[model samples]
Target: MIPSNILNIFTNTEPSDISYKEECLTCQIMGSATCLVAGAYFMSNLPFLGSNTSVKRNPIWWKNSVKGAGAIIFALGILRGGEGWLWNQEKYLTNESK
Candidate 1:
């Protein structure tokens, strides 16, 4: 499971006192969503790599492998963005409270 702090970074609602930055929000959401989807799709397929399932024998296996590799890369993006989001949100909130 993703850590709560990290998930919070990707999932927080906009702060009420803050001005909305559409570009930032859109980028964050899109990046995170894309990363999550790609990662999940790839990671899910990874378990099948070693399986004796018919999928292993299919030409699709090669495609799946490629996708799996892409997913890992995307997942890393999610991690990076998630950390940044959390940190920024924390700083914004703390400063606002002062």
Candidate 2:
């Protein structure tokens, strides 16, 4: 069985009366933060948190791979932003008409 927390992520246990604005805000915040953090790591060599902290120690292919992955992640976050906003809009309209 899937863990409760993991399952909860796939399900919305919130009450029907909850506002869509709140949900959208939560999603946007989470997505933006994730993308920003990951993109920063991929593009920099700040410290231990950065994947290229020891660029000289690692190989060229690995660095390129990390950058590619980061770009994909950032794009996904953009898609998520649109999805989250649209979901909230649809839900809000449906709820209002009910």
Candidate 3:
């Protein structure tokens, strides 16, 4: 029989009991930073139909900018909101083995 310790590695892990509050807090801060930088870039660079008369408008620019900004907002929101609910919960975990 395989050693129990080795078998444990293959088995579905029990829900993580450690809250990892510190790590979550760190991620939230980083996510906020990501949002700020991304937001600034998108706002300044992604505008369509600017004042230049020769500039041709591209629809893809707006779509991609909105999509990227929305994704960042969503990820950061999860990180920030998760700190209070996800990590603190007794049953919640990111277990992929199950």
Backbone clashes in candidate 3 total 0
Per-structure clash totals for the candidates: 0, 0, 0
Error (Å) of candidate 2 at residue 90 is 4.4
Of the candidates numbered 2 and 3, which has the greater TM-score value? 2
The TM-scores, one per candidate, come to 0.38, 0.49, 0.35
Stretches > 4 Å off in candidate 1: 1-23, 46-71, 88-98
- lDDT (Cα, tens digit) per residue for candidate 1, span 1-98: 75557777788887765564333556767787877777776666554556546754646757667677877867676765775456657754654555
Instruction: Please write out the lDDT profile of model 3 over residues 1-98, one tens digit for every residue.
Output: 65567677779579775644334556666776777566655545445436345434556565576767766766665556565466655433443223
> Taking the tens digit of each residue's C-alpha lDDT, what string does model 2 give over 9-55?
67967857544434456867788778867876775544335545566
lDDT of 2 at 51: 48
Could you tell me which 10 consecutive residues in candidate 3 have the lowest summed lDDT? Answer: 89-98
TM-score, cand. 2 vs. native: 0.49
Q: Residue 56 CA error for candidate 3 (Å)? A: 6.4
True-structure RMSD for candidate 3: 9.3
Best-to-worst lDDT order? 2, 1, 3
Candidate 1 vs candidate 2, lDDT winner: 2
- Per-candidate Cα RMSD to the true structure, in Å, reads 12.9, 8.5, 9.3
Please identify model 2 stretches exceeding 4 Å from their true place.
Answer: 1-22, 47-56, 84-98
Cα lDDT, all candidates: 0.65, 0.66, 0.58
